[model samples]
Target: MLPVLPLFVLTVILSVVSKPVVIRDSQFNLPVVRKLNFTGESTIPELDRARSQSILKRPTRIVHGDAARAVFDVAATNEALQYVTSVGVGTPPTNYTLIVDTGSANTWLGAMKPYVRTNSSVDTGQQVSMTYPSGSFSGEEFTDRLSLGSFNVTVQGLGVASRSIGFENVDGVLGLGPANLTIGTLFPDTEATIPTVTDTGFAQGVLTAHEVSISFQPTTEEVNVNGVVTFGGNNPSRFNNPISFVPLTATSPSKDFIGINQTITYGTSGFPILANAAGIIDAGTTLLLLATDTLQRYLTVVGGSNEPDPETGFYTISPANFARLQSLFFTIGDTAYEFTANAQIWPRSLNTAIGGNPNTIYLITADLGTRSGSGLDFMNGMVWLERFYFIYDVGAGEVGFATTPFTHATTN
Candidate 1:
């Protein structure tokens, strides 16, 4: 986990920041809609690659889930590094754009934009903060009303930062991770946990179930809102078949998040790359990361080689070898999920955006920094999620996957 500033240090910063506005008889009970943002917007391709690589290098902290009982469309960002949506706070409701992240817990606001204190905002006098590899935000914790779609939460714990680093052009994260990850983010009440919007909604009976389902469609455009996050249950229109439900992995750290156990094989050869390794499904990470050994094996089996682009830190595949590429298979539980040949490569049309030759093909699978057996061996990132329907059931302690229409489509 990303370390937090000591309470004593945080207190000093709070003294100079604005206090929160408090209100009474507040409760939320409506769904919310948020639009997603990609990396290519207002950013050069090189920058997206640099930021992604920087994030990948940091030690990943196992974060824990919450379901947003509302459904909203998601837009593809540059290289699809992140998916963002809009959220409103306060009675008058100031709308802020936020990254929808399931990799870490702790919902906070005000990094690019300052927190707006309205009648529904109540300063808890407790400090809250979270640090990710790409950015960190710290400020006072507050109980406020959050509106998503037609649903709303009467009291939701969110952070208002006084200062931040790394995050740019976004208000802050809307953490859809587990409530346990919020444990140490607040002070004095160190043992107390802040309920995610999903948790509060379920406790208030706003939703019939405590789960969030996500659907992302592959796109050829640089940016498009073609995905949806459904709160409470699966959207029947998103997938055609029954969902394959798999229990969360028993491994520590990895288990703390939406992690699972799966073995990976390459093409029709069925050569094993990762053998039932423990890994996570993350929305925050951009690439499908694998342990170095597994990555090497995958490269060998595909007759591909990784040549790091000095500018972006992402490996590039020669256009020649890309033509001979094949699909990769992820065998999780009783099913084998095929990562099609088209899904294995980044959008060739956007190569120049990431500082690569316009005609070059780049592989989406990259190194996870460490080798297998490190508790976390792989990261099934947004690229992978875009090909499937993912459901994270908080109360049920299970993750479900279904093949979407994009599962084998050559959209890229």
Candidate 2:
């Protein structure tokens, strides 16, 4: 079991500074570290898939907001398969390790480490609560100095979790999702929308553009600093090709998050896997999730086991069949991005970390539960993003993709 703390505690002493401090270059990068969270039991892909579906099925509402950018280094853990970064809160600041999530929009902490009140901490007197497919938290809302990289938001809204469930090892989440999702999260102020870290930074003139970009590299290590989150703008050196921009899909719930429209095909044969459909590109999810029908089509072409592995809940292929696998192509906008053969398989070296047999081959692509045409039919999660450079331009309502060195690499 994880440690549990009281509802409120004051543990740190720090001096207060003016709100919204810009202490670094216009484009600053903060280094983040990734570490694994093992439950001592086997990892379950079914739970992850259910959580992702719940995230995508969130109630839809229309709201507008701006964004900002900064660069932060991100690390990944093999067991949980998430990218995390350290964020500083309070005046002098208490650093907390937070998962980088683009699927939900409520920045919060106190799941592991209790929130330390500083001279700069202000209780908003509003109760905040957010529910996720895997976890849930209810807490008092507070605004304080939030430090991301070198940029600071003097009065960023966040939750100080009084009670939480399902979150272990990490302090909380750094929500890089749409601001509209923040609505209805606060009690009594159910109509209010809290500005995200990116939005607040841009409003305070700390960022020039309302955008954030991500770069991830495939890795076999249990824990690796294999990614970077660039705020405000794209990092030219991260990608080899020009970025291709696509308008955020207007399809229902998909448009509520970082959603887009794309089609999928298998190899040079152009075997159709999924038709042009709306889906989300999320950092919070670990697997490459496709609709049930789409996954079935993919499995038919790949010739994997019809049944999911009991332990991992992922389809497995024999070594002989694995050798016959081909790349999957994702055509977004006009460009076709290659999802290499090796990229489809989970990192073999870290197989045991998730309680899988080292000799078994697990595929990252899994069923999204619902069938296609579910607006949010597919989700390109961490495994998929690892091969491409991703950008979310909040101000322009567009998402961009570009090829990285890892796009066709055999690192997995």
Candidate 3:
């Protein structure tokens, strides 16, 4: 287990509950945003690249197998590659904005905002510490009353960080991934398993199913909090058609998280870009990252050149052949999902935000740093998720996707 030191505790109100409201038996959805410039970055694209690179180093967990899990969804926007949401911690809760992430578990506080002592806060006498690709935190573990959407979890385990780095302008994170990912994140409690909000919700009968579904929409704006995360159930209104579900890929590294298997082909020429590779769908990543081989084929077929901008680290294409770009097709579980040409590029109107020539078009896909056959090849991040409705069904051991209204929009 990682070493840790004691962090001071806050005086929390230990006894407060909302008017006895009946939590919904079905799905609960809430909106989130892609926070920008939280770390004083000049542009959204630069932040996106940094966040994605940070994500690449932190695999969700080192666990070896899959397990039964539950779910809940949160709304998110596309900004700086980090999704933000509001969470109420403690009693008579002090609302703190947090990152809605699937990459890590163990909800914590005290990055930008100090933890408010509440009537519901109880220190568990254990020191907690977690290291991410972007930041690290050391604090004390506490059980508190946390609320979100229409539900609240009593005794929700959380951390109050006394020391932190990389995370700025945010209180902490609302982990939406598996519970087992929290293993070994705390000292003295290293052998203990910390239950996530979803786990607590399911065990407390606040959620019907042990799963959460995420519905993300494509946005062309620099910043917009316009997406929904559905807990306990799927939202048909968010999807344009029936959903297709595929079992999690059995490949190592990938299987320990939300992994899936799919093949990719480029446009009308039917050129294969990826051949049945295993990868993951992560909310924490900003770009659609593919293995080196697949990215080369994509850039080649699109007639685009790799000209990385120092500001954003993304390849830029001249406007001349941009119209010649074709859609990328993904075949998952016998279903073919077409990624529109426009969906592959950054919003041209927001070009200046990333310190790029306003007239130039940049592709949202990037190289994943390694080749195929590494067990984990591609990462369908915000760019890809925005084009489809995604569901991470933990209890069912599958992932679901459907086309959205903005699936074919040329807004970019």
Candidate 4:
């Protein structure tokens, strides 16, 4: 995915839950932008609750695997909302998902006009519905402090595509991966919820390497804020292990995302790896996807080979390369952990390698362009993130690598 052809950044125009909101306070401003990863003992073992607390009064949890899929929150100013609008080639502008996706970079939601319900038309009031493949829901267009623990994003302009996708617990998605015109901008408040980028002077571009933190949001209580998700910095805990922190960089629509950027180290020498890995942190996606070139390089280190695809501009791989695989590792700040190869990788075939006798654990299908799949794996999914702890720090534009797969008794 070279780059998302600068889609008209379309943020949902939300009605203010509270009117005349004041955003003059810079207390929410991230003071520093560190360029490193942190490695240390995870206090995560001690944390055992449906949610944690935070100071800024938000929600915090190291969402991993299934728990991390297609679930995110976004906050932008009215000006930032304008940055999302754009004029489609032959169509009018529509708001997409200002999703803070981790599995994949680039912010995009369902693009459709203010879809009115069928049957009735004439006297029906203009209603918006942001539906997923699952059921139907409603997004109450209102402006409230889009809060998540300490992370306070004042999106003066936003709307709720009430149409439900998959889960009912999630309201909407927030794109934290790359810096497309999806996050910031200034424009005239048009009558429409939020216009496309073509006519709006709002924000239209990409951004990366920023700080985004989350505090646990409980049903009734002030959340504690501290677990900060910096673009590339150490977690301040467990500072001994040689954790590799990736450098944060800017990105395009289709590629990297709002908070997606980092420096990675692998092999004995610990040379930098996956500088552009930021673009591929997608929650909607179950496997870690990379361009064929990048995939080949990573597979090469692990003895994986590739085949020819004829049209898809790629080839096939051996199943063993994906099957009994090595533990894949990623670092957010300084923390580092190994990923289960068996769960993360599931290649296309078992014996379709073009060369080098390498194998794959996951399958790279043609549906990546669109989240479309069928059959058992799609139904009774045993994939990596079928249910896991994944964190997407949109403000900082980086996704945290952690999961609560075990409720084990560990060495303190």
Clash counts for all predictions: 30, 7, 22, 133
Residue-level lDDT of model 4, residues 75-168, one tens digit each, is: 2211100112121111122222232323211222232444222221122133433322222234433322223212222322234353543322
Q: Estimate the TM-score of every prediction.
A: 0.83, 0.89, 0.86, 0.36
In the range 1-412, model 3's lDDT, one tens digit per residue, is: 0001111001111111222222332222344667653444433344433443433332332222222222344555555355677788887988887787775667888988999988899999999988764568899999999877655789999999999877767787777766656767778968776777766676665665555677776666766766777766676777998999998887866665677899999888878999998887877676788888888878877877765676766787667768777888999998999998899998888777666778778888877776788877887887788889987766567788999898998888
Q: What is the C-alpha lDDT of each candidate?
A: 0.66, 0.74, 0.70, 0.26
The true-versus-predicted C-alpha distance at residue 156 of model 4, in Å, is 9.7
Weakest ten-residue segment in model 4 by summed lDDT:
47-56
Question: For candidate 1, lDDT tens digit of each residue in 1-412?
Answer: 1111110000000011122221111112221222223332222222322323332211212223322233332222332456665778989898886677776557787877888899999999998876654457888999899877555788798899898776666787777776666666788787677766766766665554566677876666666556767665567777867999998877755776677899998878787889988887876666688877888888887766655566555666666677778788999899999999889887777666555677667778777667788877887877888898988876667889999888998877
TM-score, prediction 2: 0.89
Worst 10 residues of 2 by lDDT: 3-12
The candidate that wins on TM-score is 2
Model 1 is weakest, by summed lDDT over 10 consecutive residues, at: 5-14
Off by over 4 Å in 2: 1-29, 38-42, 56-80
Cα lDDT tens digits for candidate 2, 1-412? 1111100000111222333222333222454444454343435466557655565544544334333333333223332377666789998899987777777778899999999999999999999998776667999999999987666788999999999887778888878777667778899899887777877776665665666788887888866555667665667777999999998888966777778899999989998998999988876677898988999889888989898888767788889889999999999999999998999998888788666889999999887888899897888887888899998877667889999988888876
The predicted structure with the larger TM-score, 1 or 2, is 2
Tell me the spans in candidate 3 whose CA falls farther than 4 Å from its real position.
Answer: 1-31, 38-80
What are the candidates' C-alpha RMSDs?
Answer: 8.9, 6.7, 7.1, 17.2
- Candidate 1 Cα RMSD (Å): 8.9
Residue 307, candidate 1: Cα error in Å is 3.2
